[model samples]
Target: MRSLLSKVAVGLVFVFGGGLWAASAVADDVAHKVVIQVSTDDERTQKIALNNAVNIQKSLGVDEVKIEIVAYGPGLGLMTTAGKQSQRVADLVLQDITFSACNNTIKKITKKKGAAPKLVEGVGIVDSGAVRIIELQQQGYAYIRP
Candidate 1:
């Protein structure tokens, strides 16, 4: 009887402890990361990208989703002070959505226009938007282009 009880105890420990560990693993996986690319100057496309980010955050719960939007080429305009979606960008920044503007594109525009474009208040500058997107993808972020 003593030996039987010891075996039962060991079996219970493996079953319950393993179950607890599995549950913890699932909870840890609740958070998801996504990166969005905006390469167009179109106002509609820019708004769609922002909408996609918001929708993902809402579907996943604010605390469970990490979102980044990388804008380059003509899309860099989306991160500029005079952008049509500038106010929306500011609001989303408060919600923890990251906005990345390409420095290379900025430089090109600056040289052509004779002045650097003014970025929105919360925009971050990345050396290259394409590279940023690749890095984010390597780090396991899902990518979306709208």
Candidate 2:
């Protein structure tokens, strides 16, 4: 009886302790880099993407999150200083989230509008938004177009 009780106790401890370790292991998986592709000018989807990015940072903790909002084509407007989402997006920019404006789109807009498109302060300009998405994917950053 004594030996049987000791074995059961050991089994129970192993199972319970293993569960604890699994939970903490999940916590350790918080660090991840993700790139959000924005090519459409759809207002609804644009807002959803930004909200999701912010939610991701909040839920995972900002330090553990590397989010990039890549704007190209018509989506470039979302990153423009003239964007209607200016206030909310600017606030997120202050939170250190990555915002990249596509150089190609800027040039196109400049030609059409006869002026350079303005980007939010602190946003980086990249060669092509599509190219950047491929680049990030090559570097193992998950692509999410939320």
Candidate 3:
């Protein structure tokens, strides 16, 4: 049987080790690269997402941040020239953040709704946002949906 002092020492060691592990698990990154994914059809949600991305950059003090807003469905409106968020979207583009639309989604939208709006110059068209997300994950980028 161990003495009370030994048991207390072991408990403290366990607690401190667990705390260190937890801290290491979070990307409290001094300088790290991130690739966040954004896909939402709602305007309010899109605004919130944009805010979240900005907040993360500010909070983490990331050195190289590459946020990719992958728009699909009605979310494409957030990246279009005629869309209400054009000016605000431009703000992100200036920050080196990319805004891309799902080409597959555009095809479906055009086939079903008969109107295929084009994305702005700053906004690119990817084959599929889902595939992009998987590729990013495989590349070891932390996945955040805001």
Candidate 4:
């Protein structure tokens, strides 16, 4: 009788634990994630990157997808308040897309220009753009450069 009770308890634990694990896996599978890298200041490249993000969101549905754009070096210009694409950036931000600027780039630009460039409202600053991209990739986000 004791042996039978022990076996039953073990089975119950496995059943419950397996259910929890399966639920977690399904949750992760339902959301698609992508990280886009922008290292150039070229307007065309920035536009292409933004377009890619928009297309992904439209195809996957905003609630089912996560998109992040990482800007470093000269590409940080795209995230600046005074950037040529500031209006577009702001519009995208309203749609739940994330824009990240590199702190290292901001510091360098500040040192050279005597002031830090202001990022568009709602933009986040990461310690390093490349590092952030790598971390996101490690977390299962697809990487893109356009």
In terms of TM-score, which candidate is strongest?
Answer: 4
Error of 2 at 130 (Å): 0.3
Per-residue CA lDDT of candidate 3, range 28-102, in tens?
433344555656667788887788777777776545565666777667778877777788888878776777788
What TM-score would you give candidate 2 relative to the actual structure?
0.77
Candidate 4 lDDT, tens digit per residue, 33-118? 99999999999999999999999999999989999999999999999988999999999999999999999999999999999999
State in Å the error of residue 120, model 1.
Answer: 0.8
Model 1 TM-score (2 dp): 0.80
Clashing pairs in 2: none
User: Lowest-lDDT window of 10 residues in candidate 4?
Assistant: 22-31
Per-residue C-alpha lDDT of model 1 across residues 6-67, encoded as one tens digit per residue: 99999999999999999977755647989999999999999999999999999999989889
lDDT, candidates in the order shown: 0.94, 0.88, 0.74, 0.96
Relative to the unseen true structure, what is the C-alpha lDDT of residue 29 in candidate 2, on a scale of 0 to 100?
59
Output candidate 1 Cα RMSD: 5.2
Worst 10 residues of 3 by lDDT: 27-36
Off by over 4 Å in 4: 1-30
In order, how many clashes per candidate?
0, 0, 0, 0
